[model samples]
Structures are given as structure tokens and as C-alpha cells.
Target: MKKMSLLKVDKLTVQFGGIKALTAIDFEMEEKEILAIIGPNGAGKTTLFNCVSGVYHPTSGEILFDGESLLGLSPEPVATQVIPRDRHAEFFCSLGMIAGTAERIAVNLRLFQRTEVSELFEPFGKGQKGSSAMPHKRNPILAENITGLARTVRSYVSPALEDMVLWHERDISHSSVERMIAPDATSLCEFLLYRLAKVIAGVEVDEARIRANMEITQGLVFSEAVLLALVRSGQPRQKAYEAVQRCAMAARSGQGTFFDLLSRDPLISELLPPRELDQLFDLNHHLRHVPTILDRVLHKE
Candidate 1:
């Protein structure tokens, strides 16, 4: 009995318009054996892979699997078996998701920094003028940079998804796309992660501004709390919901503060006294469970 080679590439050469990308490369792999091709950038590793996977028509050479010629076969079979394993799509998709999430966070941070108070994030750099002509400008350029980088990272998702549906068993269509996206997307995501960390670490949060913004809704944010309180106080669920909705709508349309609207509603005042109603509007009521949630999330309790 003899061990058989699972894959073999002999005398492989690939050329691109008179430029030889791969020159007489030879390699073999046995079943269940791992092989790594180590080289610096532009050392033809990708070209060699293309030749072996039938993405590029080799100038000369042969590829064999278990002694059968792979030259005339569709690229899918070879590419699927030798190049991209089952986890390739999952791995890249995860990176795209991370990039997208980071992008969203950066966008939100930028928006917060631009709001009227403009105190969510401290002005970038001491005396760092946002505009030369204006002489009184501060910008969220770091967040903007993350946003731009995320665009490039997100663009790679389509190709990765398309690569998941190669023709028959494999096709060269995804080859060029993968070659560009795989490295670029992962690299962009890496940069985004680091950039976000730096931004978050250096960011100066305005607790007062956060509290001020939370109050902008003018007690309407506590509508859910009021509703829950009404229900817990033995009010019919639908009645409680309707009462909360009416008050919320009035407050939202600038009729009055939600507390005032609810306080004046005869149906609500009968169920809860003014003091209890005021307690329902307290921000602490909504945040009472924050510590528990944080503990669960951080695995601390």
C-alpha cells in the first residue's frame, strides 16, 4: 500500500500579458496534510492559487488530484476543496458585520457631537479649529474617518455573498473579487476596531448634556413607565394603553407635557395620585435595572 497525493501542481507557470506571475511552480499535498505557501506581497502566491484552482489558464503545467488531471475540470471543484473551506464565508461575513456596527456607532457619535448642545463629545484636540475661515469650529473628524473606512469595508460584503454561490462547484468569477475583498475588508475592519477603541477611550462624555437631551422629550419618554404603572395598579390593560397613548400623542403634538396631560386626565388621576405619577416620570425608574443588565452582560454576577 502507498499513500496517495491529494493534490499536485507540477511545472506550473502563469502569465499576464507577457508578465510571468508564476514561473514553473511545483507543489504537492497528501491527504489530510496541511501545506502553507509563505511569501511576501506580490510573490505570486495568489497567481499560483489561481492556476491550481483553474481561475487562470496556465501558460504550462499540470494539476492533479489523486492522479487525475484537473486542467479541464471546472474551477469549482478544485477551488472549493483546496482554497476556500466551509468557514470562509462565515469568517468574512463576521468582519463585515463588525465593520457595519462600528460604522453605525461612529455615525451616531458624530450626530450627537453636532447636536445643539454639542457637548456629547468634547471638541477634538485642544484649540483644534474645525474651519480656518470660521475661526470657531470643531469637527468630529475621527468619527468621520471611521465612517469612510466602514464604507470600503461594507462594499466587500456583496462579493463575499456572491462568492458563496459559485457556479456548479466553483468558478473563476469569485476569484478576482475574493482576492480584492478578503484582504481589504479584513484590513479595513481591523483598522476600524482600533480606531473606534481610540475614539472611545479619548472621548469626553458630557453627563449633563446626556441628561439634558434625555429630558428633551419632556416626560414622553416615560410613557411606557406610566402605562406599566397603570396596569400594575389594576387598570385594564387596553384602558391603560389607550390612556398612555392619548397623553403621549398630545405631548408629542405640543399640547402639553406628558405629565400635565396625564395629570389632568380624569381617568388617570382616579387610578394614581399626583405623587405616584411624578415618581413614574423619574429617570431612575427606567434605569433601576441597569446594574443587573450590565452585570449579566459583563459576566460579573
Candidate 2:
């Protein structure tokens, strides 16, 4: 099953001088499955793409496509990276929208605003057809390029939403640059995904690494557990708030686990029994809602 499933990257890394941009990154994709790599900016997501697609070779580590190593392949050598499925739809949609809108805008400018194609700019000869020996020669090419670039800009508009997901992460930093890159990344990724899906197989999942990532969220994820326990007991809101806050502070400071702190605190222990407390600490308690949420989304019921 694993061997038939296709293109996978194993331990890819990119370094710039002494700094490691990507540190031993690993990824894989099964045929027709959509995998998204999302993180805060500077999290090495794009660097991983560049390495896998062969635009840039990792300073160290390996990329494999269908059991063949693509470590040294350049962009031109490898089949182009396929565009992602959603982005492909977006790109074509934007293209059609731009072409229709441009024609209408051009008509409006020519009729109501007293604008002509020649009069639109200084480079061309007034009222003359396109000329070969002068600057006018490039105007059509320039206009075409602008039209294409505009379509590119309109695609991948979703990432702007993703960019704003971070509370304090909002800065004009992504705004100006995302103006150009968001479209290009979406368009290019969609293309690559399309081309590679058939030829490539599947991605490798490193279970140990995934488990390690989940570990980092440990005590932070337990905040809801503590809150629910306090609420179910019918305790006054302020009292519950104070107890949870005190334990959270202790946990944050590395004094002890939140559950341990709650167990030791006489007031909280009085409010909840040991069995209920243990249930609150279990990670699976939070995940019990997953099947319900997934069913609602998939069935739309």
C-alpha cells in the first residue's frame, strides 16, 4: 500500500550560511489527497516547497519522487510541480473573470471617458496602428503581460484570509508581499500538484514526529478541561476563574501539571472528585467531539 501510494520527501533541509531555514523536514502525499502546510510566517513552508519541486536543492537531506531521488534536479529537469486542485479551479476562474472585465472596462474608457488605446499612454503614436520601430512595439506585449499578471493577482485570494488568522501576526509585512506571491504560489502549486499526482506516489508519515508536535500543546490544551470541570460543578464564575487562573500560572511557570496543581489545591479538590479530574486530563476527552463535527460537515445535517 505504501509503495504504490508515490512521491514523498524524506528529511529535506535548507540552510543559508549558518542558519537552517528548514531542519530535516519530511512530507508525503497520496494520489489525489490534498495536504496543506500551514504555519506562522518564517516557518519554512515555502522553503520545503522549493526543495521538493526542485526550484532549490536542500543544503542537506533528500527528496524522493516515486522511489527516485530528486535531490539534485532543477526546475526545468523535473516535470513541473503540479498546481493544487483548488488553486487550479481558482486560476481558471480568475482568468475568465479578468478577460470579461477588461473588455468592459476598455469599452467604458473608450466611450464615456474619451480614452483611446493610443491616447491611454505616452509611449504610442496617437491614432496610429501599432508601430514596429519605436516604443509602441512593446505596448501590446505590455498590455498582455498586465492582463496575465492581473489574473494571477486575483487567484489564491484565500491565503489572505489565512494570513489574517494570526491575531498579532497581522502586519503590512504580508500585505504588500502577499499581493504578488499569494497568487503565484497558488497558481504554481496547483499546476505542480496536477502534473505530479499521476506520476508521483504518496507521502511518508513520520508518526514519532507527529506525536512530538502534539506534545508541545500539552498543558495549554488542558485549559478547556479545567474550565469544563469548574462549570459542571455549578461553582460561581469568579471562583472558578480564580482557581483555573492560579493553576494555569503554576503550569506556565513549570511548577507542575495543571491537573496536579488542581489536585493539590484544597478548594478545587473539594469541588471535583479524583475520577472526574482524571477524565478531564485525558486528551481523548476533547477529541470525542470530532466525530460529531465531522459528520455534521460531511453530511450537512
TM-score of each: 0.65, 0.36
Residue-by-residue lDDT tens digits, candidate 2, 161-258: 34443334333544564567655655654443333332123222345554555555546567767777788899887888888888888878888877
Report, for every candidate in turn, its global Cα lDDT versus the true structure.
0.83, 0.60
- Name the runs in model 2 displaced over 4 angstroms: 1-204, 216-218, 298-301
Compare the candidates by lDDT and give the number of the best one: 1
- So what's the TM-score on candidate 2? 0.36
lDDT by residue for model 1 over 37-108, one digit each (tens)?
999999999888877766778888999999999897655554444366344677777887898899898988
lDDT of 2 at 77: 29
Error of 2 at 175 (Å): 28
Worst 10 contiguous positions by lDDT, candidate 1: 78-87
